[model samples]
Target chain A: MAKMNMLQAINSALAIAMEENENACVFGEDVGAFGGVFRATSGLQEKFGKDRVFNTPLVEQGILGFANGLAAQGTLAIPEIQFADYIFPAFDQIVNETAKFRFRSGNEFNVGNLVIRTPYGGGIHGGLYHSQSPEAYFAHTPGLKLVFPRNAYQAKGLLAASLESNDPVIFFEPKRLYRASVGDVPEGKYTIPLGKAEIVQQGTDITLLAWGAQVEMLEKAAEMASKDGISCEIIDLRTVAPWDVETVSQSVIKTGRLVVSQEAPLTGGFASEIAATIQDECFLHLESPIERVCGLDTPYPLAHEKEYMADHLKVYEAIKRSINY
Target chain B: MAKLLNVDNPNNTSKNDTLNLEFVDEHALAIPTFKMLDDNGELYKDAQASSMDKETAIRIYETMRFIRVFDERMLAAQRQGRVSFYMQCLGEEAAVTGSAAALEDKDMIFAQYREQAALAYRGFTLEQFMHQNFSNEKDFGKGRQMPIHYGSKGLNYSTISSPLGTQIPQAAGYAYGQKLKGDKACTICYFGEGAASEGDFHAGLNMAAVHSAPTLFFARNNGYAISTPASEQFKGDGIAVRAVGYGMKALRVDGVDVLAVYEAVKKAREFAVENNAPVLIESIAYRLAAHSSSDDPTGYREKEEEETFRANCPIERFRRYMLKQGWLDEAEDEAAKEKIKADVLSALKVAEKVAKPALEEIVTDVYEDVPLHLQKQYEQLKQHILKYPEAYPATASRIEETK
Candidate 1:
C-alpha cells in the first residue's frame, strides 16, 4: 500500500482499466495529448493510440450523444465533461437517453459499459460557474449510477468497477481533492462495490453522514468535537445515488442522532433525501430531529465561498445542535 | 463565380441547346421515385413488386387494420380516463406498418414516440400495449417509464423516447456494431419531419455516411410536426434532399400509398446491405388526427386541413386497390374491422385488470444487481409509504406480497 492523491489514483485506475481492456477509451475537451485541463486523464494518449484517446469539439451534448453511440457499438467510453457545473447541456442525453436505454429498450440494445468522469464540488474557490455539486440532479434519474470518491483508494476502486460494469456511471471526482486527499491504494486491480458506505471513524454519540470533499471536513469536525467530549461517528457515503441506507440507518439507530452534510443547496440536495429517509426508517430510534448541514439554498456564492458552502465548522455546529436538543 | 461545365461534348453542342444540354453524368438528385402499382390497383408491367404472396399482403393489411382500430379505441379510452394519454396514426398507418413489414424480423427498430403502428405490426400484443400505456405489472419495461415508451426484448424493437432526434445517432452507432458482428440485420430508426430540425439528425446521417453503417433513416414527413408545418421546417425539397448533402442514397414516396412505401423500403434495405451504406427515405403524408390525445388541433390548425388528409387515408386507398384486384370482399372487410375492434377493447379490459409491477422493480435493472444505496432508498420509500398509507394505499398493501 502506498499513499496517493485523488489525481494519481484516477490516473492509475485509467491506466489499469485501459491495459486490461483494449476497448476502453477516454476523450474530452483537452484530454488527449495535453492530458486534460486538470490532468486527470494524464499520459493516456501516449500509452493508447490517438484513435482510442482524443479530443472532441466544445459541444457537451455532442460529446455525450456521440459517446452513447460509440458505447452502443462495443466501445467502453469514459468522456469527461470538464466540470460538473457545465454538464447541463448533456443532461438530457445522460439522464434521458443513456440512463433509460437499457430499461426502455428492454435490454435489446444497451450502452452497458460507459463512464462519464468529471470533477465536482467546492473548496478552492471555483465559484458558481465551476463549483456546483450536481450529483443530486442525476441521482433523481433511474438508469444511471452516481459515484463520488472521497480519497485515492476508493477513487481507484470505484473507477475500476465503473469501467468493468455493464452500466453507465457518472463518476464525480472532487476537484479540490484531486491533489489534496491521499490514501494508500493497492497497485493490483480491485473493485469496491457500488452503493456501499464506509465508516471512517467509530464513535457513539451521533452519526455524521458525508461524502466527497465533505468527508475531509467531517473528519476535521469530528476531531474538533472529540476534544469537546462530543464523540461523532463519521460515515462517508462514497456513492450518493442508490446510497447504502442500511448502514446509515443502523448507525443512526445506534447513535440515535443524525446530521447529514453536503456542499449542495439545502433544498432538494442529497442530504434532504438522507434526512427524510432517516426520519422515516428510524423515527422511533431518534433522540432528536434529523439535522442537515448543507450549502445555502442559493447559487454557490462567489464572494463568500466559505460561508455559503457547507464546511467543517458548519458540520460541527449542526452536530452540536442535534446533541444539545 | 463558379462556371457550369457542359459535359455533353462542348465542341459539338448546338448553341441553342448548349445551356440546357443533358450531361451523361452530372450531379443530380439520385433519389428513385417508385411506382409499382397504379392508382387503379393494377400491378405495373415495367416495375416488379416484392414477392409478397397473397397471404403475406393480407396479413400486412390485417396488421394495418389492427393498428387503425387500436389507435381509435385508445383515443376514445383516454377521453374516458381509461388511459391518460395517446398519439394516433389515423391517416399514416401505411407508412409505418408497410415499412415495418418490409424489414427482416431480427432487425432492430428505434422509434420516436408516435410510431405505434410499427410495434403493432411486429407482434406487440394488444394486452402488452394496454399494460404499457396503463403501466401494469405485465408490461415488460416495468412501470418506471412513461406511457408510450414501450420496449420489447423478445421483439428487437427499442423503447420509444420522447426526445425528438436522440435515436437517430444512436441507430448509427448500433448499426456500426451490427456491421462489426457481421450480422445481416440492420437497424431502422424512425422519426418525424420535426425531428429532422434537430442537430442529432445531421450528426447521425453524417456518421452513418462516414462509417458506411447499415441503417435506414425512415422520415415520417407528416405535413405537420405538432403544429409546425413542413414549409416552415425547411427550404430544401424535403428530408430526402438533405440526404444528398450527406452524400448518401435517398428516395421520397407517397406515404399514404402502402405499396409505394413497402417497395421503397425493400429496395432501400437491399441497397444498404449491398453497398454497406445508409439510405434516407422521406414518406410525405399528413396527420389526420391531432398530434396527441393531449393536443387540441382546433387552436393551431383547422378541421378543414384534417378533412383534406382524411380524404386520402392510407387504409381507404389500400382497400380500394385491394377490391379492384378482386382480393378483398366487402363482407370480409366488414368482418375483419369488427374483429379488430372487439379484440382491442377486450384486450384493454383484461390488461387494465392486471396488477401493477412489483415494488422491488424500482430498485432493479439500473445495474445487474441493485446496489446498497438503492436498497436503502427502497426501504426508506417503503417506510414512507407505510407512514402515508392514504397516499399510496395499493402500493402499501402490496409491499408484503412484493417482498
Candidate 2:
C-alpha cells in the first residue's frame, strides 16, 4: 500500500487496466505528451506507448463518438472529457448513441466497454465555467451508470469496478479532492461494486448522507457534532446512479433523522432523489423531516464561491437542526 | 501625409522594404465531376480503360436491380397500408451498391437510413429486410427501431440511426480499432449532402484525419435533404472540398455511373487500408423519388427534372454497358426483375404475418442483465397490459409466454 492522491490512484488504476487488457486504450485532449491538464494521466503515454494512450482533437462530440465506435468494435475505450462542465458538446452522442447502442440493436451490438472519465464539482476557484455538477443529467439517462468517488481509495476501487463493468459508465471525479483528499490506496488491482456505500462512522442520533467532496465536509460536521454531544452517522455514497439506497434507508431507520448534502443546485439535484427515496422507505421511522444543505439555485460565482458552496458549517447547521427536531 | 494617398497601395515611409502581394483566383480550385458512361448507355472513349471483371460487373448490375425492385415494392406496400414508412433509393442505387460492392465483406459500413442498397449488397436477405420493416420477432433489431433501420453484426453493418451524421465519427473510431488490429479492413460511412451540414460531419472527418484512421466517408450528394435542396444547404463547392481543409484525400464521382463509383471506392479502400488514412468521396446524383413515401416532390421540384433523371436511370445505363460486354441479355434482365419482385412479395407476406416481439423484449437488452428497477417497471407494464387485453391483444398474449 502507498499513500496517494485521487489523481495518482486513478492513473495507477488506468495503467493496471491497460496492462491487464490489451483492448483497453486511453484518449482525450492533452492526455498524451501533456499528460492531461491536471496530470491525472502523467506517465501513461510513455508507459503504454502512443498507440494505447493518445491525444484527440479538442472536440467533445468527436472524442465520444470515436470512443463509441471503438467500443462497438470490441475495444475498451476510456475517453476523458477534460471537464464535466464541458461535456454538453458530446451529450447527444453519449445519451442517444452510446447509451442506446445495445437496446436499439437488440443485443446484437453494444459499446458497453466504454467509460467516460472527467473531473467535476467546484472549490478550485474555477468559477462558473469550470465548476459545475452535472450528475443529474446522466443519472436521468436510463442506460448509463453514474459513479462518484469520495477519496483516493474509493476512486481507485470504483474506477476499477467501472472499467470491469459490462455497461457504459460516466465516472465523475471530484476535482477538489484530486489532491486534497489523500489516503493509503492498495498498489494492486481491486474493485468496489458500483452501488455500495461505506459507513464512515457509526452513530444513532442522526444520519448524514453525502458523496464526493460533500463527504469530507460531512466528516468535519460529524466531528463538530460529536463534541456538541450529538452523535452523527455518516454514509458516503460512492456511486450515485444505482446508489446504495438500502444502506442509507437502513441508517435512517435507526437514526430516525437525515441530512443530505451536495455541491449542486438545490432544485433537481441528486440529493432530492435520495431524500425522496429515504422518506418513502422510512417515512414512519423518521423523527424529523429530512433537511438538505446544498448550493443555492444560481450559477457558481467567482468572487462569492464560498457563499455558493455547501461548506462544513452548513452541514453542521443541518446536523444541529435534525438532532434538535 | 498631406498629399492624397492611394488606398489600394499603402505608402510606407519607414523602411524601403518591398512586400510582395499577389491575387489568387478561387477558380484555380475547380471541382471535377467524373463520368464514365454517356447518356446513350455507352462508355466514354477515354473511360474504356476501366479494369472491371465480367463477374463483378454482373453482380453490381444484379444488386442494383434488386434494390430497385425492393424499393418499388416497399413503397407500394406502404401505400397499401401494410408498412408505416419507406424510403426509396430510386436514382442513387449505383452510388450505394457500387461503393459497397467494392469493399470486402469484413470492411464495416456505417450507413444513413436511405442506404438500403448497401445492406442488400452486403448479403442482407429479403426476409431479413422484411422482418425489420415489419417489426416482427424475427427481426434482428427486435422491433424497437423504425422501418429500414437495419443492422447486422455478421455483415459488419452498423445499426442505422435516424439522427443524421452520427455514424461518421463512429466510423472513424471503428477504423482506428481496425488500424490498431493491423487488419486491412476499413469502415465506409454513408451520409447525404444535407447531413454534411451537421457539426458531427466536421468532427468525424477531423478526427479521422488527425488519428489517421482508415475511414472512407461516402457522401451521396443526391441534391436534397428531405424537401431542402442542395442550393440552400451551403455555398461551398461540395462535401469533397471540405476534405482538403482536413488534410485528407477526396474524390468527386458521377454517382450515376456504377463503374466509376466502383473504381473510385476500390482505389479508396486500397489507399485507406494501405496507409491507414481516411478518404472522402462525394458522389453526385439526383434524387429521382420523393424523400420518402410521405413526401411529394412535385411541391418542391418540377416534373421535367424528374423525367430527365428517369431517362438516365442507373439500372438502364449499367444494363446497356453489360449488354455491350455480352454479359447480360434483355430477356435475362427482365426475368431477374420478375424473380426479385416475387421473392420480395413473398417475404413481405411471411414476415408481416409473424408474431410481434414478446412484450418483455421492451425491457430486455437495456443492460446485459435486467436490473431490479427495469424488471419492476416491466412487471408493472405487464399488469397494465393484462388489465386491458382487448386494447393490446398482441402485447397481452405475449406477456405470459415471455415470462
Q: Model 2: residues >4 Å from true position, as ranges?
A: A1-325, B1-18, B22-27, B401-403
Model 1: how many Å of interface RMSD? 16.7
Clashes of 2: 0
For model 1, residues A262-305, the per-residue Cα lDDT tens digits are: 89877788899999888999999999999887775555533234
lDDT of 1 at A161: 87
DockQ (C-alpha based) per candidate is: 0.02, 0.01
Going through the candidates in order, what is the number of backbone clashes in each?
A: 3, 0
Q: Against the true structure, what is model 2's DockQ?
A: 0.01
Model 1 chain B poorest ten-residue lDDT run: B24-33
Worst 10 residues of 2 chain B by lDDT: B8-17
Candidate 1: regions farther than 4 A off: A1-325, B1-33, B36-51
Chain A TM-scores, per candidate, are: 0.98, 0.98
Recovery fraction of native interface contacts for candidate 1: 0.00
- Give the Cα error of residue B23 in candidate 2, in Å: 5.7
Worst 10 residues of 1 chain A by lDDT: A298-307
| Per-model RMSD to reference | 18.6, 21.4
User: Which is the leading candidate under lDDT?
Assistant: 2
